[model samples]
Target: MTEDTAAGNTEAPANPQVKMRVLGQFIRDMSFENVMAQKGIAGDVQPEISVQVNLDAKKRPVEHQFEVSIKLKLTSKAKGMEDVLFLCEIDYCGLFHVEGVPEDQLHPFLLIECPRMLFPFLRRIVSDITRDGGFPPVNLDSIDFVALYRNELMRRQAEQANKTEA
Candidate 1:
């Protein structure tokens, strides 16, 4: 029996351990529309806000640099009515320097890890924009990137299955 096998260290040594750095971040686009003020709707009310997030990643022209971004769309409405208080959409992005991640796993890493780093800044931006646009600040809830990634994968699989069945 081989000594290495008996020692139970069967796995190959990992080369070029994972490395990542946030090179930079920026707001790609942002828009805030104050629907209530524009429509002249005013009343003491509670707001129901719905937030949607989408993530994207792409390789930059520079080697080892990638851009990862998240677009957040928030629609706020007065409670128990069809009145829109405000609509906000922001695309926030980060440039990352990454190395050592396997090619097969890069997509998930970009979509998940990069966005996790960018979300807090997005939350703060949302809060400020809401406050500035004359509504109470909207603090976003924490996002589960792992679950999101899994759900997206499942959705894509389902889409492929449907295409095949059709």
Candidate 2:
């Protein structure tokens, strides 16, 4: 084969390869202090949980990758009053296969795709937890992870720029 032909045949490595496996998943932390919540709300109450999602990624020494997640805080409050019923902080993570990936392309996949893949499971857990806690099942609205990721990146860049100028 000619050198030029050979060079043309070569393809760029796939970025952010995912060899995703559910390594081990459990309630990393759980609290069901329903008694206090019930006492706090002595009548029929509708509860709501506000969620904030965060995504982080890191490469391993070998081919593996880590997606560290903080699903933000979920605070359940009564429908009428401003009192909080319960609060939960769920921190979860996943191990991913990230091989044959270019350095430049890795960040987007980690920030966008990885979280998109993991969000459904996390959402299910939250819903189940709320239901089991005797409140109505909490169904969270779907998130636009790409937008969230881009905003976060922009915010970080702005912060860094401000710091540099300071």
Candidate 3:
């Protein structure tokens, strides 16, 4: 109020530009089961696909380094009979070096931005796994990380509200 008001300047100081780097990435675990191969299929079949995504982040012992993991679970089944065609699950992780993010913004940054960076690799793995398992290759649609984060936040808030009411 003293110097700034006198100078006719009211804007706050600008935040530093965010800095990010992907140190490395890898698949921590993967399992693909081809049920159709084992049981054999005999009919005109329609496929239904379902996919689930979960994200986790942890700070590493090394400074400025963190680990973020994306868990992808996908399943395909025959439309009406509900016979499972195949199941593919993967846990992919990335090591990142990040700086200049505010403490309050870190959680969403890790969950959203980090996963976005790793999504293409995970998508390719899913496509490859399905193609190799003798099914029509699954090309996953792009995920909405911003919506995912907002939905998660709303869910947690509702959960907390329910607990308090109880």
Top lDDT: which candidate number? Answer: 1
lDDT of 3: 0.92
lDDT of 1 by residue, 38-68 (tens): 9998778899999898899999999889999
Q: Write the per-residue lDDT of candidate 2 for residues 1-166, one digit (tens) a residue.
A: 8675678967655555444554444445556456436676566777766776776676666555555464556787777768787776777666666555566767887777776777788789878877887777777788898899889989999999999999
TM-score of each prediction: 0.91, 0.77, 0.90
For lDDT, candidate 1 versus 3, the one ahead is 1
Per-residue lDDT of model 3, residues 1-166, tens digit only: 5988899988888998899999999999999999987897766678899999988999999987899999999989999777898899999999999999999999999999999999999999899999998877899999999899899999999999999999
| Model 2 / residue 166 / CA error / Å | 2.4
Q: In every candidate, how many clashes are there?
A: 0, 1, 0
Task: Please list all clashing residue pairs in model 1, or write none if there are none.
Answer: none
In candidate 2, which residue ranges exceed 4 Å CA deviation? 1-27, 32-38
Best-to-worst TM-score order: 1, 3, 2
